[model samples]
Target: MKKSQDDAKSLQERALRLLARREYSYAELMQRLSRFASKDVVEEVLDHLSEAGYQSDQRFAEVWIRNRLQQYQGEQRIRYELRQKGIARERVDQEILAANPNWPELAAALYRRKYGEMLAPSREEQAKRMRSLLNAGFSYDQVREALKHLDSEAEFD
Candidate 1:
């Protein structure tokens, strides 16, 4: 019993130190703490942090989404990344919708930045640019809207 108590305290301290540096989702905290303690102990520590309002998956998701958006990443990539971090699909969708970004416009700006104000003269060139945007996590609609004005010099703005 004493051993378990000491382990819990140690895990708590380690968790606190990590949280001090940055917010962590419950899943992330558990993965980190599980390396040093049992699953039960890690869960208990995480529960304690949750109760104390030290760790929050929602907050982590929000911050992570914001950071990724600032990096001009697409919604698909952001959703995938949040899911990989153990955030729920519902929560990911909720946060993304709340951000209210203009996907088509963002896609246009990204394409313009990468390929410049030049139009793809050949079918092969157009296909290559389309492939690049699609691979960058843009939806078909967004990609289409982005390339719709490929000949317009002021399309990027």
Candidate 2:
């Protein structure tokens, strides 16, 4: 009984410490806590914390989305990453759609920053640029839109 109480206290403290640094998804917290405590204890602590509002998947998703947006990541990659973090598909879609970022403009801006106003002079170069943008998580439509205006260089000043 004493050992159980100690374990419980330790788990809660560790959890609080982790949460203090930054937000964590439920699965992330559980995986971390499981290293120190039993699965049952981790579940109980997580439930209590969640009920008390210390842990929220919704909040985690919102912040994660904003952070990824600054990195100019596309929706497909963002959705995949959020799912990997244990957010449900419905919630992920809701959060992403709700944010409603202009993906085409974003893609164009990123393309300008990387390749500049110098047009791809050959078919191979155009295909290579397309592949780069696609690998950076853009959809085909967004990449095509970005390609159309490559000559209009962005004014950084």
Candidate 3:
């Protein structure tokens, strides 16, 4: 019993260390700590932390969304990332819809950063780039709109 208790404490401490470095969704923390704990202990510690105000899904979601936006990742990418972290799809969508990120502006900024002062690629090239952008988490319409502006002028003020 003592060994079990110590192990649980250690997992909590390690989870805290990780959280201090960066916000993590409750599910994410559990997944990471579960390597060191049983499923039941992981759930108990998570519940304790949550009740003590040390863990929060909404706060985690907010910070995750903010970081992704800063990195120019669109809602599609952010949602996918959150799901991969074990956050519910509904929660991810709720946060993304609430965010309503400016994909057009973000895509434009990313395009400019990567390919400044160069002509937009040919339609075939642009299509490939578009696919890459989509894979990077942008929507089809957002890519089209951003590329339209980019193709219009190699040098945008």
Candidate 4:
């Protein structure tokens, strides 16, 4: 009984230390703690931390979204990353809506930052640019809008 209590205390301490550095989703915390203890023990500690309001999936999601936006990542990429972190789809959607990102503007801005004002490139060059944007998680329409914006800007220059 004493050993069990000590183990739980150690686990809680480890969890608190991790939480102190940055927000972690419950699942992330579980995964990290599982390496140190059994699933039941990890769950118990996580539950306690959560009850104490030291761990929050909502806060984790919000911070993650904000950081991703600062990196100029698109919505699809952010959603996929949050899902991989075990955030529920409903919560992901709610946080995304709360963030209220302007997807088209962001896409255009990302394109401008990456490619600059050199317009009317070769067909191959255009395809390469499209691929880069698509891989960055922009959808077809969003990529097209960005390219269109680029073309218009080039015309003005």
Tell me the tens digit of each residue's lDDT in model 4 across 1-157. Answer: 8987898999999999999999999999999989888899899999999999999999999999999988788889999999999999999999999999977778778777887767546999888888887877878898888778778878898
Which parts of model 2 are misplaced by more than 4 Å? 149-157
How far does residue 110 in candidate 1 sit from its true spot (Å)?
Answer: 1.3
Q: In terms of TM-score, which candidate is strongest?
A: 4
Q: How many Å off is the CA of 25 in candidate 2?
A: 0.3
TM for every model, in the order presented, reads 0.88, 0.90, 0.84, 0.93
Worst-scoring 10-residue span by lDDT in model 3: 112-121
Regarding lDDT, does 2 or 4 come out ahead? 4
lDDT of 3 by residue, 1-157 (tens): 9998998898888878887898888888888888888999999888888898888887788789989898878768888888888788888888888887779878887776766645445877666777777877889899888877776765554
| lDDT to native, each model | 0.85, 0.86, 0.81, 0.89
Q: Residue 154, candidate 2: how far off, in angstroms?
A: 9.4
Ranking by lDDT: 4, 2, 1, 3
- Best of the two (3, 4) by TM-score: 4
lDDT: which candidate is best? 4
Which ranges of candidate 1 are over 4 A from the true structure? 149-157
Q: Which residue ranges in model 3 land beyond 4 Å of their true spot?
A: 1-3, 117-121, 151-157
Model 4 weakest lDDT span, ten residues long = 112-121
Clash counts for the predictions, in order: 0, 0, 0, 0
